[model samples]
Target: MAARTITNRKARHEYHVDETYEAGIALTGTEIKSIRAGKANLQDSYARVENGELILYNMHISPYEQGNRFNHEPKRPRKLLMHKREIMRLLGQTREKGFSLIPLKLYFKNSWVKVELALARGKKKYDKREDIAARDAKREMDRAMKNRHRE
Candidate 1:
């Protein structure tokens, strides 16, 4: 199967992910086919605990072209299938401190759709800048090492 990525670009820029979980998504046949065709988007997607269950919101799965009126909504709030204990833990973490449920990536795993959810904290302006600087320094160091090896 061809590997595809549906990534939440803003999540990386906004939050520092502390942990990640892979959860199954409740998807219909048409939605699954559409995702297989690489027509899914996770740009603004997020997850929340509601009624003791995890629900995904703002995720856009494009409608299957061959589907008729039975096609699923592109932006529906889909349920995420996670264990009860995991859900409770996520709820506690999110409710307590700077943690939030953010969708990091969406992809097919063993022919099944899976969402990679991150427990993250929002980064401040200074933190973001520091991260950028650190990344730049790491890149420069890597380049220097490569040049030293070449010489």
Candidate 2:
């Protein structure tokens, strides 16, 4: 089967990502099935280092259709597996003002489920405007280049 990836599209537009790390996610059997079916969401989700462990919060993995009473909670807090040292580093980095941990993508790595976690800072309104302007300018430049090539 083709590997599936679920991405947080708004994360980049809302935050300035500094670093990313691939980490394994701890999921229940039903949750795994749900994710395999591409029934997960990363919107309004974030991660935190609590008691030396990386825990992802607010990520919504819909319940498995056939799970019955065995279905996992759709918005349960999922623990992320990483080396202790890496978790420590992330903890320290997130301690800085305005810095936070956000999940950028969720996908299958081989047969295992993995999350692409990012260390990011929230962007101000002016910063967002500047980004939009820059993107627009780049798009126009690309269009102009394409027209020139055609001519």
Candidate 3:
């Protein structure tokens, strides 16, 4: 796997992810430079397909410190690069009820910046609670097993 430069960890807890796809991002020079410096955040960011193209919204890539007047906007809607067929498939999926297009992660892929877009369904409040409980149970089990093995 290539290096995951940034991620939206909250997305996993908030949605039931169905499928994920990778697409290149259209970033300005300063935007890319800042991202390389680990100054990007995916909180509250999402993606959508529009007019046969995929667009990312609310992604915050901080301006390069030395960019001066050439820095890109901190929060801009950037275009995503993906195949037409993929975009069409996403369009079909998104047309269904309660389905959404969301960006799961941003990463460096062979020297290019790529975003991992997920097809997800929203989770209910009860579902979130259940997931938290299950995770805690699993962590306790792992810790108990480790203690036994150490004896």
TM-score of each: 0.91, 0.95, 0.95
TM-score of 1: 0.91
* Residue pairs with backbone overlap in model 1: none
lDDT of 2 by residue, 1-151 (tens): 5657999999999999999999999999998888888999999899999999999999999989999887788998999999999999999999999999999999998889999999999999999999999999999999999999998
Residue range with the least summed lDDT across 10 consecutive positions in model 1: 1-10
TM-score of 2: 0.95
Candidate 3 matches the true fold with a TM-score of: 0.95
Clashes of 2: 0
Each prediction's Cα lDDT score? Answer: 0.92, 0.95, 0.91
Q: What's model 3's lDDT at 103? A: 89
Q: Write the per-residue lDDT of candidate 3 for residues 1-151, one digit (tens) a residue.
A: 2234798999999999999999999999999888888889998998888989999999999889999887899999999999999999999999999998888888897799999999999999999999999999999999999999999
